[model samples]
Target: MKGKRVALLALFAAVLAAVAIEPAAAQSGADSTTEKLIWDLNNQLMYIAVPITVLVEAILFYTVWKFKNNESPLPTRENRRLEITWTVATAVILLFVGVASYQVLAEPYVTATGADAGVDTVAEDEEILDVQVTAQKYNWQFNYPEQGVTNANTLVLPTDRPVRLNVTSTDWLHAFHVPGMGLKTDAFPGQSNYLLTKPTDTGEYQLYCAEYCGVGHSQMLGTVEVRSQDEFQSWLAENGDSGGDTASGNETAGNETGALSP
Candidate 1:
């Protein structure tokens, strides 16, 4: 009576807990390879550990219950074949995990992304804009070396253009992440790495510092503005910016070749 009711309530609580826990676990960091690797390994460990733990517990309980003192000094059988079988099975499972992760490892480019294939595929006379992202203790800054532009809290990109993002940190480690373009990378001090991305639809993508650097880590965030080529050009001109090459090409960002009037 009461026990049955208690059991039902416990099952309901478990179901609610599982539902609440799973979505948060799924969305927290599965979006990045680094986080996914951690998650995948944890999942595998549990999958294997749970069954092995149960089996070992069952064996221990059975042995104690059934053969407390009757467990004789009988012949011990060494099962080399069983050991080899389990070893091979475990290896195969690990191999499967490695193979399954290929897609995640290749996401920033290699798939529907014309970045490595070359940005010209998206539009004529256009190349991907390369931006260097640097991190500090409490904030993020972006540099468009070619454009001779530097700014904080705001990243501007031409819509429909590929961006080759070279990332690094000026202080501790930080992660550059923009969800809309499905891009994220670590900004490690003294070490430079890059990622490729294209903004298909024009919009503002939120940027966050994924790595915990200090007290303000959780508060570090920025915005990336994706605009049309013309709008970008206008914006560049408004900011008096030029790709290191020289705005001598255009007064705005989109114009590849134009000279600033004296």
Candidate 2:
């Protein structure tokens, strides 16, 4: 009877541990290609670092315990083979990390095109949805020049479709960062930056200003709504302004044309 109670308690403890650990392991991600690559690199580096950290700590503790309170200690000779082995091992590990990082960066999904450089890789295709982003003191304005729509603090996107954003600031510097989409670009005054992404899931994601601008920086918040292609078209039709080109048209034209002014 006593043995059975102890076994039950141990099983209960194991169940509790698993429950506690599962949520931490299942943290949400950006649900995009760029974020997946970054997370893969992070997990791989942790796998490589954890064992080395444990081994070094074990060696340090053992050395301290073995030589505790020793008045006289004999001189220890260092082995040349050990030194060479560690050096070579470290070099090989670094080489592996560098190669892996380079491969991820080389993918076509991650790219940066200057303001006046060639057409944006993502935007070059005819099927792309272009949204011009304007950043100010504490707000973000998203303009769909093609659809003739201007939305403030809310960016709407169509799922499963490629999106290209032209980002620039009017007053101060800001960073347009959407963690769920794994897209971030700087909003510089008089200069344009670009970011491309495709949201696979249909949900609302949070957007934030990654750079600190002023006192209202903490309140610089926005939302990105991902909808189906049909729903997106319907939204554009309903909310779009017909007469005025509220969204400045800068694509395929001069760079200074589409500055989102007040």
Candidate 3:
């Protein structure tokens, strides 16, 4: 009994060690919603599954040690209740996991969904600021259509209001994912894409290409800067560039462009 208890305790300790998942070292800010979902799910899953696993293993080990009969055939028994109990329990747990996490799936994405965001969309209403996000083989562009401002590699937004981003790619398919706000949108050539978010916290969040576009796909990176409303207006004035060379006026080496919706 003492040996069995020690084995069970060891198993439980091993299970508990895997439950604490730290955020990725390379990422910062409140960007990825997936990370938040991980935070929520890990605890529940650990608590639910770990003990079950440890207990089952402990039982198996105890049986092997206590009931080994090398000279005789192993006893075999059929227990319908045990089988059905396990099956139903597993199904119930799966169903609960799905239902409990529906909020994460239901959160509105950062998209004004143009060319398709429908005639009457909520994005039109929450349009405190409008910045156009575009994706290419390896870079991102942010254009402020209302202010006629454009730039590459960096994005700015105002606090406490809905910021609608109308986006599309001039090249292959790419995903604009920022972990902080739990937001991402696909940028497709010709066809338009949209993303919308309200940045409650003020900070800088790193952006990534969530899709594998091409050779330079992994090199693509961008940043989003959230500021106060007044500061944001000042930023619009300072970084604002004439839509003249604004037709993909990437001050950088190689850049791409696409038409964005209001």
Greater-lDDT candidate between 1 and 3 = 3
What's the ranking of the predictions by lDDT, best on top?
Answer: 2, 3, 1
Q: What is candidate 2's lDDT per residue for 1-262, written digit by digit as tens?
A: 8546545655565556556544553574546656666676765665566556555655666567768988798897988999999999999989988988887666545554643322444445537678889987677788888888887777999987777788999987999998887788789998888766666778888999999877667777889999998999998998786413432332212222223223
> What tens-digit string does per-residue lDDT give for candidate 3 at 23-79?
322233343333445445555665666666766777787778766865676666988
Q: Clashing pairs in model 2?
A: none
Model 2, TM vs. native: 0.74
Give all candidates' CA lDDT scores.
0.63, 0.72, 0.67
Per-residue lDDT of candidate 1, residues 1-262 (tens digit):
8546545655565556556656665665443233344466555455545455555555566557656778565775899999999899889867766765564454555232322544434367667788877766555667777766776667888866667777788767889887655677788889876776666556787998887766666667778888888998787776654333332222222111112211
Candidate 3 segments exceeding 4 Å error: 1-38, 41-47, 60-75, 109-128, 241-252, 255-262
| Ranking 2 against 3 by TM-score, winner | 2
TM-score order of candidates, top first = 2, 3, 1
- lDDT-best of 1 and 2: 2
Q: Which stretches of candidate 1 lie over 4 Å from their true place?
A: 1-104, 107-126, 241-262
TM per candidate comes to 0.51, 0.74, 0.69
